[model samples]
Structures are given as structure tokens and as C-alpha cells.
Target: MATTGGARPYRPTLRAMSVVTFNVSGVEPVQGTFDDLGTPLHEVTFVVFDLETTGGSAREHAITEIGAVKVRGGERLGELATLVDPGTPIPPFITVLTGITDAMVTAAPKIASVLPTFLEFIRGAVLVAHNAPFDVGFLKAACAELGYPPPANPVVDTADLARRMLTRDETPDCKLATLARVFRTPNQPCHRALADARATVDVLHALLERAGAFGVHTLEELTAFARAPSPQQQRKRHLAEAVPRAPGVYVFEDARGEPLYVGKSANLRNRVRSYFTAAETRPRIREMIGIAERVRPIVCATALEAEVRELRLIAAAKPRYNRRSRFPERVVWLKLTDEPFPRLAIVREVKDDGCAYLGPFGGTRAADDARTAIHEAVPLRRCSERIGVRTRRPACALAGLGRCGAPCEGRETPEAYARHVTAARRAMTEDAGIVYAAVKARMDRLAAEQRYEEAAVDRDRLAVFVRVAARMQRLAALTRIPQLVAAAPGADGGWDVHVIRHGRLAAAGVMPRGAHPVPYVEALVATAETVVPGPGPTPAASAEETECILRWLETPGVRLAQVDGSWSLPVNGAGRLLARIELAYQGRDERPAREGRPLR
Candidate 1:
């Protein structure tokens, strides 16, 4: 069985028809099976459906009109059209586009009156429409609201059909009007139900001839062929539909349901959907799409919040697909402790307390260029000995290159040299005052010397530093010292925490951050330590609360630790990551460490 357009071939209610054979008496029921017709349909079966919509998007928009025509064996059926009152004011744009005005629908039968008959007529037919999915989605939504199950029919877009059918043609256009013109079918008034329905029929006739030449007369074969994108693309498409329009970070998971990719964006919905869009055919996206099983997202307030969240998820999940870069020359940092020949190092890894990292830049080359710019602006030692904390004599190798001024050889005092280092650190991390001060000072000096070019360069650097540094410190409050707290801000301006150990609850409590943790800690930690006589009530949590727990429990270790001022927990098992992290983070400070160890 083959269906055209978007309709599926399903059981149908056969239309009653009368035949006369010169009978004067009442006619008897016709007795025959499908074979009695004596001929089988060889051409594609098209279930052409039409709709007048209140607007575009299926999610927010409603359908105002429906019309359909079933065609097979080059014969089109009589029109089956219905008018629907969308239950809301139809905009003027809709009225202009569809020519379905309010007064006309005021007396017309509503969708409910015609739905049963319409569905019965369309069953066992492949749905067809000029732009089929739009109509089908509305039909499905209407059916659901009417307490009727969806038709479960796959849609075939006639617009897509035309595109494929004439891919090589250099015609005027591919719009319905152009399609009609190409086939020399008379132009029908736009937006009228029966007229557009008839035009669609003409378009399908022209398309089928081209499609049949490629052995694609049946809808089933073409549908199967079109659905062959990697499983990743499919899952990504599914996730794109689910994400809300918000700013956030999205995590893409692998087939076994593990996080494989983590990314952030100011517009979470748009950014995540980009990976699933048709143009994402690059090798990296293809691979990510192949492995991705889920797209989970967390909303944030700003682009910087999104960036911080993205970095946190990447570090915590250690997604197998995103391997961190290993090149040392590409990493940029602020040498906060550098003094007496202070230097700005371009290195891959962050060394403890030696320097503060500011970027994993757009690319390795940008980072290298930034380092070059810094070195040009401020002379410093660039030798292995000084960087490694070894004694160095005379000037380092970079002295002859004008990058080092031999400050380590007592050409400049350590205190005087420390000012430059402070300036650089401020430019990278704090970003607020130092860059402006340096630029203004240098600009004033250049202007006094009448060197406008040099002054302009300093001003531009000042602007660049301001922008980049602003991004780095966007979530300053988020990356603060971790004070053990019982809960995060809840939707209702309250907090929640549950105390459980060995898969059972000993006590559950909630306390404000300003309140002392001693009593709550005592109760929660005791739950983890005390052996209960019998199994306690299982933890009762809403979906959102359960989700919060599951996310926290998934970190790498069982015990909790703070990473760069953010609260973190460790996990041993990959499969139990979500559950484990949840348990660890819930009442984290309250649970005293095992064997009399300190909670901190």
C-alpha cells in the first residue's frame, strides 16, 4: 500500500455510492471484496490534504480550514473540504493569506461537526499536501484535543516533491504559482480552499511523472530513502524540538546515554538546534550526531553564565568526545606571581598559584597572537631558566629580540617590575581599571610627543582588553569560595535537602543558609552513620527535585570536593554518575566524612 502527500494507508470508511441497472425494485447490497474491483492501483496513492492556518508555527498556531482529495490511477476524487473556527481571533494577515474571513466561518460548521466524517474518508491513505507536515501537525493536534488518537500517518511534502522533481531546472521559481505556470495549469485564486486544492493536484501530477522516471512512484520507498541520516542527526532533531527558547548550556549524550559533547550559547534553543540542522554535515557534527542519544540543557542568565556553565559541564563530565587540546604554546595566562623580570607565559596547563588562566581562546593562533602582542607592549624575561625558577645570568635569549630588558640582572628592581605584571593580570582577569589606566597614560604620553598613531594603537588595545576581560569575569560571583550550603535557590524562594545513606533515608530537612548548620548537619550526618532498624520511607521528590539530585550525583567521585571555588563531588561509576552526584551534593556539608574525618 502506498500513500502520497503526508497521509498513511490505513483502514478507511468506504463512501456509499449508487449504481442503476434499470432496476424497478429496491437494490440489494453489493457483495464483493477488494479483488472484485478487478484492477490494482499501481501508481502512488496520494492523500492530498489542505489547511487554512491562523499562522505558521505548529506549536503556537491553529488551523482554520481543511480540504483533501485522494488520487490514484491518475484520477482525483471529489473535494472533501471543511471550515474550522480556530477558537481565537484570526489575524488580518491570516485572513489576507487564506481569504477565510471571520463572518464566513460564523455560520459554517466547526471542525468538531466534520472531524469524524473527514477522518473516516482520509484513513488508509497516504496524506498529501502542498506543504504536508503543516497540515498534518494541525490535524494531529486537533485529533488529540478531540480525545481521538492521532492518525499516525507519515507526511509527504509536495513542496519538497517539486524541489526534488525539478532540481536541475532553471525555472522562474518553485512556488505553487510557478509550478502551475510551468505545467501551464491556469492560475487559481490564491488562498481559496477548493482552488488551491485543485492546483496542488495539478502540481502533484507534474511531479509524479518526474518521480516515476526515478522509480519513486510509491511514497513508502521515498520515505525510507529520506530517513537515512545518521542516528545522531535524528536525536539532535528530536532535542531541537524539545529545547525551550532560552540562554543556556546543552549537553549531548552518547548511545549508551553518556554525555559526549557540551556546549554553551546565549540562545540555548538556537545554538543546540544548529547541530541538528541540515547544514551541520561537517565531519565533527556527523560524528557527534552519530553518537548523541540525548540533548540536555540548563538555562542561564547571560552569555558569560552560559560560558561558565559550559566549562563546568565539560570539566565535570569529561565527555569522551571532547578531548582537551595539549599544545602549550596555544594556552594564555596571567603570570600573577611573576616579579623581577615578570613574564606573560603562553602555556597549555594551569600551574598551581603561578599564573591564572584567562582563556581557552577561539583558536591556538589567537592565543599565540595575544601573547605576542603582550610581549611587544611590555618587555619581560622569556627564558626557560627564569620560567622554571632557575638562576639566570645577564640577559635572557629574548633580550636581543627587544622582548626582555634584562630586569633579572638588576637593570630594574623587582618591585618596579611587579607593576607591569600587575597591569597584565588586571588586563586578563579583573579587566575593569588597569587597562584603561595604562591606555590613558600611554595615550597622554604619545599625544604629548605628537604621535597620534601610537596613541590610537593604545586606545584600541584598551577597548579590546575591556571587551575580552569583561567576558572572563562575567560570572565572578558564580566562581566564588565554596561555603558549604544546604540548598540552592528554589523556584518558590525556598530551599530543599534530603538526607539519605545506603539507599535509605535517616532524616530529611531544610534550612536557610543564614541558619546554623550544626543541628541540620547533626541530623543528616547521623542518618549516614546510624544503622536503622528497618527500611525507611523511600525519598519522595517531585520531578524537578529528582532531576536536580540526579545531576549532582553524576560527578566523578563519591565524596564531595570544591573545584576552583565551585562545589563538586567525585564518582567511581559511569552508569551511576547522575544518581551518585545527586546523593553526594544533597546535604553535602551536613554529611560528616567517614572514620571521624572533617566534613570540609
Candidate 2:
């Protein structure tokens, strides 16, 4: 389907193959799970075909001729060429181009009879064509109309294959006639079906030889070998061959073994191999694949452990390819200012000065949102200036509006303001019932008055406040414990046991059904890594790691095996309040949808 173009004939030389990384870094994850390249190229049967249609559109056109050649290992097994009698008269322009006059095809076989034969010939063999979509589209459209199932054979485009190796410096463009001339095939195209297909066969063989230098010798590799991946990506694909099909982390590195990217997946082999496939469309990932010289896989006992390891590795390496979670220390915390008249402050550091902290928020906006919500519930001062017992300043508009106690003006006593501080502190660390109640009352009053927008505004503030408070309290409880052992039911009734030290995953294993948990738990704890506790809420590990541990422990059906200290929240805690706020939000969100209004 290619027209002749003025260009110089040339052949391209591929870069020489280099050393590849085929061995995995850590222990084998799971036996017999690694993917192997299927079916070598020379062993595959390819049906190279071409078609001459009456028009450009597959829906509007009819096939005038079908020509194909079946080949294996550079030997032609058979050739199929037939004039298809389109029921409709052939267009004048098409007749002039293909030289197939109306009288010549007046008694030829109809497409309905020819389709069954064509489908049978291409069955179980890879189909090859130039600009394949045009030819394959017509064949598939005919099959759909004639009650015949579409052929399932894989397709390869010599046009695309030529583009992979030939650049503009060597060839002006990728066209069937151009390639046929460049490769100097025995058969030449003259707008005839059989001749063009035969010309494409030689072009394919030359392209395959070029592809062989890139390590694309298998049918699977050829399909994924679209643009002929960079020499590194094509060669480094073997690094994923030895990985296990289990939950773990994978690190891509440069030739010097410097980390380029760190990621985790429930199945390590499948995820790592995706990098070398056409399915990975991210431009940055493709670039990383091009630079990657090796892949280091670390298999974990559980998915949660894999996730925790990914975060830790990303934070440690600060890989340029990863866009998030590289600098956990940059997170902000909402600290209750330790003073005579305390106020909520969004600070970036966590100190051991005995001040109540509420977060490790990823951004200042989230910390500020939660702070504003808490201020809506409690009459805490919002001034940036520090205030002590002896300090004095004029009352602001908030104090005049009765929103604050005006401790700066000495209009409110420290003793009297201490009560409000106590309530705010309790909301931050232990319970949020008072904060949730105060906000809910205001929201309900606003809703009853038909001020839904105002009510939603209050709801937004309360949402962030309750969620942060609940999350921080959960993290604090677990991080305070010196050691904890827990188990969750795994597949086939096995138990995924974990030893957590100060909210960090120290050791983990899978305990078979009917196995003694106490002995297994004891052994795991004994072998667990040592963690020297730090100060503040997160003592041994990061706040993110503590949150991960909390989520694993809170999963349904998970049972506690052992604990070194008490790990409990207040009876009236933020967990219940967080659930109520979530339910209220769900209803508010659904109301707009049911009423046909746009939802936020």
C-alpha cells in the first residue's frame, strides 16, 4: 500500500548489544512466576498479505484483490492471490491505478466466499502488512458483516518496523516502495497486491535482522519492541526475568548502581516487566527505562510491608523519577503553642517541649484548613504575636465580635482562658467530641434556616479537623508502644504475622494454619531489628510509617498477638466523631446528585 517516493537507498546499522542484568537482587520471591519470552522469531509462522480496495474508507470500499504469502524462516511455504469480484462497479480512478478492469473481475469470486479462505490461511500465524490497519480493517469489517468471527492473529506493520531502525538521515520516510528499494527485494511493487506483499517480505526480513541486534528475537519481544527501545531498556529487560511474582519493592539503577527510581507492587515481576512494554506510556518512566542498567528487587512478606519499604527507600534515595514521598521531614505539624494563653500554630518541626501536636500534614494548606476548623469549634486566639501573662494589647475585631476571649488585651484571664486551651488540647490528642459537637450544632442550625452553602462551609472545616485529629491519635497510640505483634488471615488460612517495634515493621512471616502463634511470635520478636526510640510522638520511625502500621493493625479480622504496653484511645475519641462526620458528608454529597445539581 506504499507509493514510490524520491529518496536515496540506504541501510541502517544497529548499536552493538552490551552486558545485561539477568540476576535478581534479593531472594527469589515466588517459584515459577517469572515471565519468559514466548516463541522465538524464526519459529513463528508469518502470513504477509496485501489488499487493493476500490476506495480509501474501509466502510465505504470493496476489496478488488487479495494477495498473501505464508513463510517461515525466510522460506515461502505458499502464496495466495485472487481477484475479488466487488459486487459494486469499481471506481474509474481505482481501475486506472490498479489496472483491474470491470470485465476482468466480473466473474471473480465474491468477498463472502474469499473471506473464509483468507481467515483460514492467516489462522494461528502472525499477520504482516504495510500500514496494516487499512488492510486489517477491511478484512475485519467484512467478517463482522458476514457473520464470521474476526481473525485473532497478531499483526505486524513493516512500516512501523522500518521506522524503528531507519532515521531521516538514512531514509527520507517509511513507505513500502521506499523500503522495498532500500532492501532491494526481488519482487517490486506496481500497485499490484501480490507484488507489494512479496516486496514487504524482504523488507521484514531485513528489519528483523536489525532487530536481532537489540535482543528482540521473540514474537512477544517484537510486539513490545515498537520504537526499538533505547539500547539500555532493550538490554536491561532481562533484569526482571529472575524476579518473583510476589509483593515487593523494585529499584531501577544506573550503570554506577545509583538509584534512579523506587517503587512497590503486589506482584514484583509483572510490575517490573511493564516498564519495558508499550503499555507504560508515561514519558518520564520511558526515560527512566532508557537509562536503567539494573533492577534490584526486594521481596516482602506482605503487601503492607512492601508499601512501607517503598516509602522508606524513596525517602532515603530521593530518586529523581519519583514525584512524591521523598522528603517526609518537610511535613508540617499543628502545634498547640505552649504559653499562658495558647493558640494553634502550624509549625514545621516536632520538638520535645511537651506541646500537643496534631499532624504531619503533607502541605501547609491542609494544616491551615484543620487549624481553621478547630478555631471554629473552640474560641482560641488566632493572633500570630506571642502572648504571655504580662503582655497587653488592644482588643481586635474578633474579640469585639465575641469570637475570641481577647487575652492579649487582658480582657480575659489566663485562668479563665485555660479552660478553652484544655478543650483544644483534648481535641488534638485524646477526644474530639466537644469539637465535633460544636461544629455540628452550627451546621444543623444553618441547614434548618435554608443556608445550605453556609452549612457546607462549616462541614468542610469540621471534616479536616476530625480526620487529622483521628489520624494523629491513632498514630500516637501505636508509636507509644515499645513492641507489638499482630496477625492477619492470609490466603489458604495462613496468618501473615508482623513484629512492629515503635510503629515500624521490624520483622514479618507467614504462619501456616494450626501453627502455634505464641512461639512464632516470640521467635520473630527475637530476630527483629533493633530500633532506638526517639522523642516526640513518632519515636522510632516516621509518622508515615506509623500510619501504615496503624492501618495494617486496624484491618478487619486482624488479631493482636502481643503488646509491651497499653495501646488504647479514650472511650469518647475522634474515631467515632470521624465516622459521624464522614456519614454526614456522604448524605450532603448525595443530596445534590439526587436533586440533579452539580456536586463538589
Candidate 3:
């Protein structure tokens, strides 16, 4: 006869002739305690389960029965056993294997009716099974068919635990029946769900005892033990012990106390702990960890602040493992020489020379592209030889090619070359329309002739020029402001304020939570150092510093508190050229096509 009970009550069972009491419940279990290594194995609640199905494939099979035993701190809490009607015919071969005949399940409840009760019984417990993927796969499939998300409980497979815990001599195979004999469980294999589940409970305890010898006392440690640590990682495990569980940046330093790497994370302790695991695949990171003697963390109030601090720290420390933004001072700039001819030149350092400057580009390549765009539009001198007012110099080949005005050979008078220089400077600094119009006209001509590849090249060149020009113009505008104060609402009801003097960050701090920002703002400005504008060609701010400030200013809810100088873009500025360039690149030209045939 089939039993109609929902769930079996916990029963007192004898272990080694001593009777042990057990508690049974269907409600969610209370959460266990967690320490640094995570919840101890003894305190963790586990649901040891096994499923009998029609076939091996989850997608093609249907569950015939389910058996589970919930245990906490070595005490059996409850048991669940049910025969589910698959809603399909039970094959003759399946009956021969499990002895569950079609007649036996005809009166059983359908899987849809039994799954809910099983899920409720196992809530707030770690799932355990011998060959867990088989059982978990079927349960997850049923959940999906019912339009419910699969249970997210962490699973432990005894088959995997056996491989990690026991030697081949102790257990010749990882099969449940083989492990059952080796562990000497009270129940024997009977090809039934409840019998196998009761047997698995004993196997779990045996493996836990073996795991304890390797210092795997906690659930997290046991889960991670398969990827065993190396001698080096084990020795350095103490480095991550003191890191706090908070959003922040971590600096890995060597014996000399020099930073080897810098990284940011929302949880400092967990992120740092991952480095000592087998999951860390980067060779350079492993090398850094091997050499690291200490790990330092700087906690931040918010993720945004952590990112900002990471950038600042990387720029300041130039850590060996850090690859980007290491040398902000090495960023190149495009300078128009302070001379009569005033040719465009790529320079590493910004000077206070009377020439117009275009960039703090990350590399010379971007500056070269911008220079090419300007030269194609305005016929400025292309020669590198220094030319004086009366110094006689022969014309370079560019002069004959009509690519240069050739101020070197006096072929173009100083006055005439100065006009070209002025046009180039205007395209570089105040307005990019002059150069953008030329590039766009060429791109449109190419597209009209169906020479799309050449058109793309011109389009890319214009993109580089316009982007750099817009950035340079914005930085220049900000630098013109003698003093500026901006503030944004920070995390935890505080205000993050920045003081800028001539485009450089003069002072930055946060107003305490629940405090009025007006007084803090006044005090910040009063104590800020006065940064006088220099007469050199270099702007007051480095490109990295200016970019950082720009990012902060463009934040979604940022507000301008005060501005002693104008913070406005020119009416004919390069900012206007961006839209036109984008439109041309999209194959839409607002201007009429030229009459001439497209150049090859």
C-alpha cells in the first residue's frame, strides 16, 4: 500500500548503541553562524537528497521518487519521502531496475503537487547528494517547467567529496554502494530513495572527518579544498587576514614596502583572498603575489570614490603590475611652434611658449593624426629645419607637392605663411570647423564615387581630430577660470566638494553627513592655495588630472557652487563640429556634393 503522509517525522536513532534525539520541522531553518573562514561544517544545515527517475537525461526523463534527510549539527532534523507520478507511462525496464511498478505510482501524487512541499522542506539548507548533478538537474528542470526559478542553494556532491577526501586504497570506486560499505553506514543499498538517502547521511559525516585533518573545518574551506593551495599561497595566507570587508582599494607591496600592484574591490577581504586560490590564472598576478609581503587596504565611502582613488594611486605609485595611466607626465601634446611659420609639432612637455597647444594625448599617434588632419586642410610648413627671418634654406620636397607653403625657402612670405598658421591654430584651439569641413568634403566625395574604404579612412581621421580638439578646448576654458567650486551629493547624505584654481584641483574633501555644505565650502576655499597662471605653453593641469576633473563635473547630479571666472564654450567652438562629423560619418551630408569627380 502507498503511504499518504506529506513528510516523515524525525525519529530517534541509535549510533554505536547510544540513542540520539532529533528535531523535525518544515519551516525555514535558522541561519548558522559564520566566522572568517565561513560557516563551520557542524553548524551548517544540510539536506541530503537522492532522486529516482525514468532515465539518465534530465530533459528526457521524469522523476519517479524523491528522498531527503535534513540534518544540522550532527542531528537529523526531518525526512521527506514521496513517490511522484511522472504523468507518463513507466517503462518495463525501469520497473525491473527500481521495482517501482506502474500500479504502485497510479495512486501517487503528480510531480507538480509534490515539488512545492520538497522545496519548502529544504529551504535555508545546503543541498547534498551522491553525484549531485543528476538529482539537481532534474529538480531544476521541473522548476523551469513550472515557471519558477531553480533553488539557489549551494550544493555538495559526495562523489566529488570522496575523490578529494579518500584515497583509492580506502575506496576502490566512488559509487554510492561502494562508499556505503567503506563508511559502514547503518542502512544498506536497496535501490530505494529513502534507503539511499539515509545511507548518504553517514557517508557525509565520514568525509567531513577526513576533511578536518586537512584544516577544512568550514563549509567555504571544504568547497575550495579541491583546488589545493601551493606552499607559497599557504605561507602568504596571513596577508589577506587583516583586510576589512568593505569597498576600497588594495595595494600589494613587496619587502621594500614598494607597491607592486593596486586593485579595487567592493569587498576587500574576499577579493584579496581570491588571489591565494587556484582560480587565479594570470601569471603576472601570481608572480606579484609571490613577491608580496603585505597587503594594504584603503576603505572608501562609495564605489565611485574607490575608482577615483584607484586612478590617483596608480598615477602616483606607478606600480609594476599596473599597465595603464602609469605615467601621466609622459602623455604627449600637440604644439603649434611659437614662430612666424608656426608648424604643428608633437611635444612631450608643455611649455609656457606663446604658441597654441592642442592636446595631452595618451600617445604620439593621436597627436600625429590631428596634425595630419590640420596639414591636409591648411598648407602650413612641413619641413623640420629651423628657419630664421633671414636665414636662407632650400625648399623641401613638400613644397613642390603643394602640401606645404614652404616658409623655409621663403617661397611663401612670412605674412602669407602667418595666415596659414593662424588658420591652423584656430582649427586646433578655438574652432575645428575649418579642418572638419575639409575632411567631410573629401569623405562625401569618396562616398559619392562608391569608394567606401577610402571614405572610412578619412572619417576616422576626422574623428580623432574632432575629439582631441573638443577636449583641448574644454580644458582651456576651464583653465581660464581663476577660481571655481563644485559640489555633488555623496554617499551617506554628505557632500563631495572640489575646489579648482585655474583648472588644477586646489582642494578636495567631503562635508560630514547632516552638516550644511555652505560653511564647509567657504572654509575649503579659504584654505585653498592660490595657483597663479603660468606664462608657459603647458596648461596648468596635466591631461590625466583634467580628465579626472571633467569626469567628476559631468557626473549626473553635479552642481556648480561658485565661479569667479567664465565657464562657457565659444559660439563657434569645436564642440559644434562633433555633430557634423558624426552626421557625415553616418553617410548623411548636409552640404551639397562638389562638382569635381572624386579623387583616387
Candidates in order, TM-scores: namely: 0.38, 0.60, 0.57
Best by lDDT: 2
Instruction: Give candidate 1 regions above 4 Å deviation.
Output: 1-45, 57-59, 152-154, 168-175, 187-189, 219-222, 225-476, 479-560, 563-600
- Residue lDDT tens for model 2, 1-600: 111221222122324333234447765454331134466676779999999999987776789999999977667789999999977778899989999989989999999999889999988999999999899999888998799988889999888777666765777778887877777777788888998888888788778777766667678888887745544456678989988899999999999999999999989999998887656645568668878888999999888889899999999999999998889989898999898888899998888788888887888988888887788778999998888888888978999888899999888899999999998988888778777777778777777787776777777777787887777778878887888889999867999989898888899888889899878888888999998777667878888888888878888989998889999887777887866666665644224422211112
Which of the two candidates, 1 or 2, achieves a greater lDDT against the reference?
A: 2
> For residues 229-328, what per-residue lDDT tens digits would candidate 3 score against the true structure?
5446777989999999988899999999999999899799999999988777454676678799999999975554566678778989999998887888
What ranges in model 2 sit over 4 Å off?
A: 1-235, 244-247, 444-454, 489-495, 510-519, 587-600
- Model 1 lDDT, residue 71, Cα: 76
Q: How many clashes does each candidate structure show, in the order listed? A: 28, 0, 6
Name the 10 consecutive residues with the lowest summed lDDT in model 3: 1-10
Q: Evaluate all candidate structures by whole-model CA lDDT and list the values in order.
A: 0.55, 0.81, 0.78
Model 3: lDDT of residue 299: 92
Per-residue lDDT of model 1, residues 134-166, tens digit only: 777888877876889898666667676665456
